[model samples]
Target: MQSDLTNMQPPCGQIQRRTFLSDLGYGATGMALSMLLNREGSGQAASTSSGAATQGPHFTPRAKSVIWIFLSGGYSQMETFDPKPELNKYGGKTYADTVYPDPFQDPRYQERARSVVQVKREHDKIMPMQVGFRKQGESGIEITDWWPHLATCVDDISFVRSMYTTDNDHAAEFQIHHGRHKLDQKQPVIGSWLSYGLGSLNQNLPEYVFLGSYTDTRVKENFSPDYLGPKYMGVEFSLDPNNPLPFGARPQTVLEKEQANQYALINELNRISSVEYPHDEKLRARINSYELAFRMQRSVPEALNLDTETKETQRLYGIDENETSSYGKRLLAARRLAERGVRFTQVYLSGYGEWDSHQKLKENHTRSCKRVDKPVAGLLKDLKRRGMLDDTVVVFCTEFGRTPAVETRGSTKMPSGRDHHPHGFTIWFAGAGVKRGYVHGATDELGFHAVESPHYVTDIHATLYHLLGLDPTRLDIPGRKRLEIDRGKPILDILS
Candidate 1:
């Protein structure tokens, strides 16, 4: 019976179903190919690789890499590094009569202006900074009451208090990341520029890496390589302390031999396609991406592994504690990447209400400060101890700043929080050629605006590139002209 069944033939019209199915599959694949061809011909399928080999900065640089620490929400200059006594004297009064001119009162901020007053009415009278200020180190720069840990390292940092931005809202977030006004033409981020200019120091590792708690909110689709193409865009890593970069671990079932076989088959197909379309940059980029993906499969995992680090070293970064562990691990990872020649690393501080202080100004800022204080100070100390500080530049910045006026909305008796202030803020720089134990700029009597020698975000970018041995003005790509936004003058006054 089994033999008879095996030899049985189907009816005339049902002549081998397998053959029919294979023909249908081939027809569908051909149709898909035709559609792809049509799309390419219509320019709907764009290639993002044509701008890969642009010449970078023109001059010899001093620093090889940078580690950026971005404080997401506006950190209050008055509460943090910039101490002002006038805010205390005129605490509860409206600045409606002052020369400060309600800079944020434009029609764009009408809603925010209304909300600010409401918040102020409910919260406690313009609260004085809970923490005291002290002159630290030989420089005698006044640092806020909350940052004793950071104060100890003042000799290793340059504090710029007169930094200002054009945007008043969270949109400044985009401006700082992309180095252009939020309203202007979007440009490649500072990191992407560096990746394009320097290429990768470690082929196994990405040239640009972003790690932090607010990774999702911070990543912009426009946070891309833009005209420089996909090759220069940063490789974003998850903020997880254990595993950061996506797909950084080894595959369990896919053995080396199987991967190699698959790669060879893909390569053969790509080669044949390349012959048919020799001028296709997209095809070339795809081939390069496959090769990079394979290399990353090996290099990323090795770079992320923290088991080799000494237990004491881990503890020094506050990895042993819960509150500080996550950010601490990120900082340590950044340091490790810096040591391994990663050109750009950004570590974001996580958690809700991180420097926002909408309601509980004292409790909120204090708690947030404690969480990062040790890890940041430790990162600086560790870098200096290892002699990496001389070559690596560490930047600490916030989006904007909190207002000097008290916010009283939501409650009338609670400790008032500050609103967003874009006129003036503070940022600190350490390592590379930055002058240590120095303060470069200042705000006025009320600490409301940058009244003395104000600097913009572009100045920071220029200074950073200068430290990294690149002239910010000279980086250029072929064919595409450099825009005015790309030509930034370096702030030489603060350079060591």
Candidate 2:
């Protein structure tokens, strides 16, 4: 009674591959990476179908796609990027009326007293910096006033402000995308650990995509890949550039060359059941996810075609506005899936606890930073005028910070919002191999502690596997293990 199909079908007895290749040189990394790309198209031009370079960030990598973005229900590190002008010079006072140091008598919040959520009357008061800072570019840095278009790209960003998360509630949005602790032991996220260890410059797509939505039902661990299974999870997408993978397309009563001869007779019956299940790595990742979901229906409708862009690149991602056209068409379909190499797209802005201001910390972060500052400063000025920001890395984050005192639940009155500060926060980074207009660790004079040099959110997944060159301690998984704080580390003083 339900199925009318929208995209992604295969389930109900999977394993496929009736035909070998669809030809037309399938493009955008499909038809099994159009038989493994060469001639640059980057994603590091391809590897590991054997010819070696083995599964890893083993070495040399600046980045080859990581868009990331984030932001759900927790945006206020003293009203954006750790600003605490001494909480407006001691706003209303009290952490025992102030000279710092009382984050509930530390001990990392007393050994995570059941992961911090009891504040009903604790709103501690002081709540000052409700937004209004200046400085901005030439690296003056200050930031907020609801990001006047991400403060003119602040010298291609860097920030970091000490971040620290242990889940003070809102599962610190699953500990900022599964760096664990939402009740522990749950690794594999960093787009399912780079879709289970890299190697793909596009192959039509889904080398990890997930674009938006999450009111925090434990935020599907932001694209979980639990024991690194389900073919290294993350997929999600839907810019609907003609049904981007849900019930997955292909019905108009079937004839698109009869749905390409019904997927070339189901890839000749899954290439004769992959020569009798030859060690089935999840049935060869479900016959390469059904020939990469049938070549991502012709390359995700030409990478979610925004009428092939331009009108000043659709008003530089404000997409002809409407409060920034729904997160500017999902950050312009994550910069057209990272200039067509799709290693880990992510997105998720607004909605689902819409930056949970708890009351009205200045009208909920001034309308969630005007629904995402001009589509994230037009995706860092269209990835730096299409040079794809030195190998594409981005990352802008949220999910912990707000409540430098002043979040009085169940009416304590005069406490207009903010409560959930996993002790400290702020995040930012841009383009591969970091360190640009910079600003690294600090928070306290009331942002309440990430004090200085704090990080620990899998050191932002060990600085995105050290800018996609990988080595999150030699990635591995045969009987699962992971942990040395899940190999985090890499802040290496913000790289580059």
Candidate 3:
């Protein structure tokens, strides 16, 4: 009976029917493919009832792709970009000891801080900047010596030194991408929204791709589509070119020709199922996803093939150096994917909370900076030289910044490190629509608050959407009414 079913072909006028067992085995791939595709709407478009164009870019798009580089733990704003010479001057002094107004006394301190857990403020004494800073690039932006490579590219970057978020812990990692505190309901991340609102520039690859390590399961929320459905979730890729995708490669036992034949049969079956249940959105999505999954099996590996790149190009990403090789590969792959039309590529330069320098601020930050600085700078230079930077927005950000005050609880009684400071931080952007070599907004002299042109995490989302020609307000579904905060106003000051 199995042999008969496998060999049988339906007459031209009649429908082909297979036994349930035959369908079950061969249909598994298609079913899995549907889940992989995560196609929730029609081909290349969203099915929102907002009466807005679902295939987005509601206005003229300045960027074609986004390279969102996230450092999992907080990097100090004062030490990195904000450069608080005051911290060094006021070292060992309490907030009241400083001649300047006490930061903790500021009315906005309690207003901005929404701590998930009660934080013990034992670190009362202010800590000076652990690293030295030098003016860099034509912009003369005062960057710490740790990021000597990235400092060279400062003239092309726009620094927003006053970015802040409500979440005061590691949860801010999720908030940076989704624009909501972890206490609040999970909303669709920026990458997911972009996936929902826009069509694929490369049909073979996912609209949103995640590269690098995410061993911390909680970080998964950063790429989730949530209400947008599973298909819109960021598809993670392995740096290993031989095995780039998860469950994406064909089984060795199944010859290429045989698998192709099976997919064809599945397609026919899906086509028949579609006609029988024309309104089954899930079925339609599955059909689309299966097709894409098949294409991805071939295309994704090629996109990750760094060996094909010249020795110079490899060195350009710092791939030759042991210190920078791992992160270099990811950034280099991101550039490859972006140039090939991947809409959004989220690269984790380090693992979860790796930058959370609760202790050893100098040691931790120096090692962290070394791992990413060269690769990041290389990405910018390569993008510019290849003309990809003209339409690719590169965002360099951390979850938040370390506190200006010293942390005295763990082991060290002396002020050796800073605690988590959600009050204010710095994030930067380069390429695409943003003005080059400009600094917008700032922290107070003490680096304890976002004292100028402060922006919530969502403002970054709004800026990205605007640059990509998406109207965040218009990307709504029928039932999901987003809050005003969720649809944050774009930072117009930074836009070119």
List per-candidate RMSD values in Å: 9.2, 19.0, 5.2
Alpha carbon deviation, residue 41, candidate 3 (Å): 8.9
Residue 300 in model 3: lDDT: 85
For candidate 1, lDDT tens digit of each residue in 1-496?
A: 2364324587877854324433432232222222112112212113323223443445677788899887777888988899987666666666664545554443423422222122322222344665788898888888887887888899898889988776666667667767666566667778877776777788667778767654354454324666666566666666453545454333556566666566566567668666656776555554455555556666665676666778988888788989888888789889988888789997766542367777777888888888888889889999999999889999998878877777755555754577777778899899988898888889876666676777777778888878877765556554555565445557677898
TM-score of 3: 0.92
TM-score each candidate: 0.81, 0.38, 0.92
Number of the top-ranking candidate, with lDDT as the measure = 3
lDDT of 3 by residue, 169-225 (tens): 788899999988878887889998887777689888888988888767887788888
lDDT of 1: 0.69
Error of 2 at 472 (Å): 28
lDDT of 2 by residue, 136-242 (tens): 88979888778888889988888888887767777777667768776677776778677567757766776777787655566766776666554556667667666
Ranked candidates, highest lDDT first: 3, 2, 1
- Models ranked on TM-score: 3, 1, 2
Quick one: best TM-score, which candidate?
3
